[model samples]
Target: MGQEINQTQFNEQAFKEYNRRLLNEAELLQTQLTKRCFSDIGEICGYELEFWLIDHNYFPSPINQAFLTRLNNPLVVPELSCFNAELNGVPLPLRGDVLTAISKELSQNWLQCQEAAHGMDSVLMMIGILPTVRQKDLCLSNMSDLKRYRALNEQVVTQRVGRPLRIRIQGRENLDINHPDVMMEAAATSFQIHLQSAQRDAVRYFNASIIAAGPLLAAAGNSPFLFDTDLWDETRVPLFEQSVEIVDEANLENHRVSFGQGYARESLFECFAHNIATHPVLLPMLMDTSPQQFEHLRLHNGTIWRWIRPLIGFDHDGTPHLRIEQRVLPSGPTIVDMMANATLYFGLVRFLAGLDDAPESRLSFDQARNNFYAAAREGLRAQMVWWNDSVTDAKTLFMEEILPMARQGLKDLKIDKADIDHYLGVIEMRVQSGQTGAVWQRAYREKHQADNLQLVAAYLEKQRSGAPVYEWEI
Candidate 1:
């Protein structure tokens, strides 16, 4: 989806050519894996954080084409909406001082982005959902000027036979609405964490990531309001799911954006095989690249928006590697807060995947999927069935069990002691005080009886303070 397409419309011949290349690439990947041909890149980490561009009044600003040009940073680019932009971190090895190095680099890049936004009398805000966004702001006119995005919108609507997209979210309040295009997906942004695992442990690491989703999201929930109506702690989950739903005659998968069916039993190859077998081609952009590049297979894989996605990438030497992309966390309350979320994720998953026994064996997949939705809806207040099959509140489970495992995981990774203490301390305080971004937003609205404008005004002020969400005053 990052790459631009040459044409928006495709013919039957285009689909046939694309599928032919996809099959050849899938077979080549299988042969390479059977021969153990992939190079082992020990645990490496990266991030893709999405942010909103708001004007002086804190409303959405549609100027990213100009904003990105003025900014002129390759690492930062336009997102689905002109009001949104994404920042990508350079891949770093997960070892001593890596966490601190990530923090310093992010701070530096963010300073440059802020300067560019300031020049245009606009600023950037990183949150799951901006509370002040109106329904009018999500039209096709606001979409970024990219052919791939335009083609994606056309393909999704075509799959639905021209019926308008329906979105019905049930939270503290019921949100039943209809949208004309796929731009409603632009309303929800995320802080996606990526880890390039060793080829031998890819399956275990991928399953461990699925099992860790509930605890991590419960602690990092930041999106509680949409269009001034109170919704789930992270309303982005359902909003993104229903925004671009494709109704196919053969329902191989229920929805494109979901928690997945089951854990990986043999290998991650099954995921790519399933992608080839189940999904119809959305973007049939037949490429003229060699089979080794896997261009057609990759472009097809990009269209499926699984919550935890498997990515295929090449290293500096052109060796293919398997990466686990965790897409469940929201963008932010602060840069440190976002990095702290990364810390917990890397550490806990390392511990879980490296265990002598499999954690997924003790916990069923059904409970894992159920726990995810429960955490999203209730935040720290939700009760989850943990590894021991005990249904406990997410807050207590974190403080007593999950946090300690994460601390041990970081120590095992050989991270600096200072980095562990500072980052984990932020998360510890957050869980202990019960003040995730969602919790703070709900408290502010209840106490002041304020409108959405006032809420956003106060949020921007505190966001500028560089204080963690747990430290914000209601």
Candidate 2:
């Protein structure tokens, strides 16, 4: 059982005490983790993609009850909402052309989810944010009936009292959004990829991922608009940060949480220390006195902060493994598209870990952060600055530089050639066509101005019909 902390109860004394405890706990965890063998190069690799659920009528359904009653597979897991379900693929070793294996598994999982959705008249769609997710729908009433979900929601909102969250974005157009509850966070859905490597290489991989994130995200943009408004290239970027931000004047003066602090050091422990130091735990777990408590520590770490999360799991013989799970990507319109993103990432990690780039001081962390923001703001249309001395459009970078390097990297790893070509080719085609999920959604939102406010139903219908974005009939 986890103890849920209320933000309102946090005073200066409590804040100091909490930080003090977190620092001590982190030190102990670090000492224990350091003594164990954590792989420095890539060994284990995996992904987790989440989707929003809809019924035949293209409306948000309370049909999770029916779907769960029929779902029996171990892989089809429950999410925070009855209207959402998650599909976790098998973990593959980061060896011998994993692209084909990952693609086959992801496609199979999607197919399984589709099959489970059939009898219940539900469908799964991958968009940055569901177009029709209404403000009213974000209430506690609409939340999934799970203790964890409710506990998290209560903890976040209670910390802020009844004040609506403050959200502002500057893009092609400026927008301000205010929501009284945390339900607005539910509007966002994403396909997050997790790459497992040893603690030593964590910083290099994490920073390299940040550098490539802008172009990769722009090229793979699946979310262009939200609530029928042409906002950021991937609106979910801002939407997610805003929805989860729990700011009180007192807490703001003491502690704060944002997308990231900046670039990372050469070790994963730096990130763990940062999280433990900066962010206070919202949910608390009761201390269980058991010899198996070490196992529980790993599980709790997984459930903490979404960005740059610390992951600890065991291997076949119960050997504890430590890795960082990245939680800042949107789910995709195609499996190949997802694989393309993964390939570039894995390549960058391998490339960076082996090469010693100048420290975070020389490479502007602000530039990296801005680059990702630029991508979210402009999609493929954005101009990006490379880490090396060159400036190029995101599409050009992906088609010529990034994609080929990704292929080479995958090849070096002996990943299946067919899988590499197929997935990388999808990314190439997406760049040439300029029709990422976000591009299509933006076009549709523009063409259907009259139906803009229909948000959920309209978008759900278009997505469920399995039609191309251009060919979609609203």
Each model's TM-score, in the order given? 0.98, 0.85
Summarize candidate 1's per-residue lDDT along 1-474 as a digit string, tens digits: 276788899988989989988999999988887777776897999999899999999899999999999989899988999999999999999999999999999889888998999999999888899999998999999999888899999999988889988888889988988898999999999999999998898988899999999999999998888877788999999899888788642453757777887899877878888888778889999888889888888888888888899888889999999999999999889998998999999999999988989999988888888889999999999999987798999999998888999999899899998999999999999999999999998899899997877888888888888999999999
**lDDT score for residue 196 of model 2:** 68
Report the Cα lDDT for residue 385, model 1. Answer: 97
Give per-residue CA lDDT, model 2, range 360-458, as digits (tens): 444577677677877877888888877554688887877767777677767766777777676666667777888877777666666775364454456
C-alpha root-mean-square deviation, each candidate: 1.3, 4.2
TM-score winner: 1
Best by lDDT: 1
Global lDDT of model 1:
0.90
User: Which regions of candidate 1 fall more than 4 Å away from where they truly are?
Assistant: 248-252
